[model samples]
Target: MTGGPKASRRVICAALAGAAALSATLFPGAAALAGPADKLRDSLSRGRSAEISAPPIARFVAQDGRVFVLDRTQPAPMLKFEDSPEVWVLSPSPAPRGDVIYKNDLGEPMLRATRLGGVTLFSRQRPAGEPVSLAGGGVPLRLGGLSPQALSERMLQASVRSGRAARRQVVFEAEATPASAALIADAAMVVSLAFVRLAGRDRDALGQVDSVRFSEGRRPSASLADGVLTIVVSPGHGLAGRPSSDRVAKAIRTAD
Candidate 1:
């Protein structure tokens, strides 16, 4: 009868509708899942880069804010920074919680408070060798400038005040929230890295070593080239018996 054909048609239509509903339920669009800020936060949280734009201005922000970086510290064969900045954004990494300003390509920072209010304050990018106003950004933040040595002292004092000491930390003098911060002593971003010979090349020799740690009392930096390891620390920090340590010898041999 005609009714049999109509009944089958209705069943097929219902099934298709049900399938569409289920699909919508299972795979929601990205906007439905997360807002722009939330997406940026998540992207940075995983040590990725995020480009944020607030009309007339857009810059890269590294979710990972580390001032002191050792290049190729741990090479993963080849490292790709799809999300991180190309030239180390040098901005504050978001804290475990709370809001903060984001920095830009020219090192000038901008503020965006998304929740309680939705307002963005922008600033002119600093020209090279020109003084940058730490307070120019409309955000009400107390920014401090210090040499790396002075910042190290402040960190020591902070640890004393809190009665919690961190043996080694890469911190900045900027007014970071209760959580994180840094500033380059001279340049906005200072990259101190060395070449290591690995597998007959400097890289091959250097890659054999797991990590390079500075145990000296004065925080020093290190570089490796042509099988020689150079340690540079503040004057008067004893270096006797440091390079002679068996660990150092092993690291050297591993590199060699």
Candidate 2:
């Protein structure tokens, strides 16, 4: 699996050395170098997409347009240890397009990968056509330079394809306790219908949504952020396993 959109757009640190060069630099002691068989095993252990036993894609590797080459052999260390250090493989996600957020705050475009203390924060929080809170009383959603129609179209397209666009978060918030899980689900469904209408795409969009989550904030609130939603529900009000409100269900059934 390749890295997500954030991984691809972060202009690879120009100061960083090539993959092999970086690997050599990190493990100059040579005592930690893995043998050819060990390298083969590591490479084969990768996901099915990566060509097994094939050559690395240049020093700057990119699997599925996202930077996958890190000078780690899974990053080989300079000193061999009794057991191989476990690798940190984040969830494999579809990459995103577009470069920086197109900001002018700095004299020039900000490098998506900025030097933040010792770590790099690739400003990739907003994927193309990201979904926002459809809650009633919350502030309006700003689509950067895109219009609601355009965003909807992009989301529909993403849904049909296998990229980040298809993975949108639909949120449902409640202003009080005893919130109905069914209501939250209905809200999510309503949002799905909105996407279908906006994009004029197939109604299969409901299938794109996988995990429907729930949470409670300080007050009765519903908002979308960090690709997440916060909502309020009773302690025993278990949801996600059943249908939503009758009104919403009727609409969905009627539509079908």
Candidate 3:
């Protein structure tokens, strides 16, 4: 975190070069002797090794005093901001100088992390990203189930708020389970936020929306079409199954 950009780049290059040499020494003629199938296997093995070595969970605090948690225990990386119920799954891509950039579903870079623990986060308030320091390891996120009655109550409240804001009846449908209840609550909040935004923009902004549906899936996503909004939450995401309200609201606005 203390190094300038140039220094950081140099360090990243040196570390990557060292890792390459080590891999070459361990695998010997892996590249030249590998057939197509062999090469694919080797590539996957290396990817697994990289995942194993990366921190499973990490905590960081930005210079602006905002805290963020990065959870890499799943197939995808999940990030959560301090004091927010939203969890975002980000796709990771390799950056120059061996850094990794994590992007949101819309392909916007949200975080850039150096191999040596330096992190820079991007946000609307700071489009260029602010460098943050590694604070420590963080608590692994989990989805704790809620009681059926509690789940229904929360869903009802969210629907009421959304309906009132949209000036129309807003129906919410979901299958209730302890794990899915958490997702339901999260989705409800997003629906409410989107409805509020629409109402603020236009008096009958959400009139086009009739009902919202929440369901569990392999991927978390939101889509609005034909007077129906569907929110898909992936239970495999653990607590990260919840999509950010801001992003969902934006998606709804764009779709409508």
The number of the candidate with the highest TM-score is 3
Kindly report which residue stretches of model 2 are placed more than 4 angstroms away from their true locations once superposed: 1-179, 197-212, 216-220, 231-256
Tens digit per residue, CA lDDT, model 2, 1-256: 3676656556464335476577678887663555766765664465223211212211222222222222212211111111222111112111222122212111122112111111111223322222111111111111123344443454344234322323444333333223443333333443343344433343453333333244443322233334333333332322221222222223332342
Each candidate structure's TM-score, on Cα atoms with residue i matched to residue i, is 0.18, 0.18, 0.67
**What are the candidates' C-alpha RMSDs?**
19.7, 23.2, 13.4
Question: Ten residues in a row with the worst lDDT in model 1?
Answer: 70-79
lDDT of 3 by residue, 1-256 (tens): 5669889899999999999889888987775676777865766556421221335898888889899888887787888888665677788988765677888877889988775457788987799999887788987765567788887887898899899998889898887566688777867876686677668776454777788888888777888899888888877666556566656676677774
Per-residue accuracy of model 1 over 132-175 as CA lDDT, tens digit each: 11111121112244555564565444323212111222222233
- Predicted model with the maximum lDDT: 3
For candidate 3, the TM-score is 0.67
Candidate rank order under lDDT: 3, 1, 2
lDDT, candidate 1, equals: 0.32
Tally clashes: model 3.
0
Worst 10 residues of 2 by lDDT: 75-84
Stretches > 4 Å off in candidate 1? 1-51, 54-89, 95-256
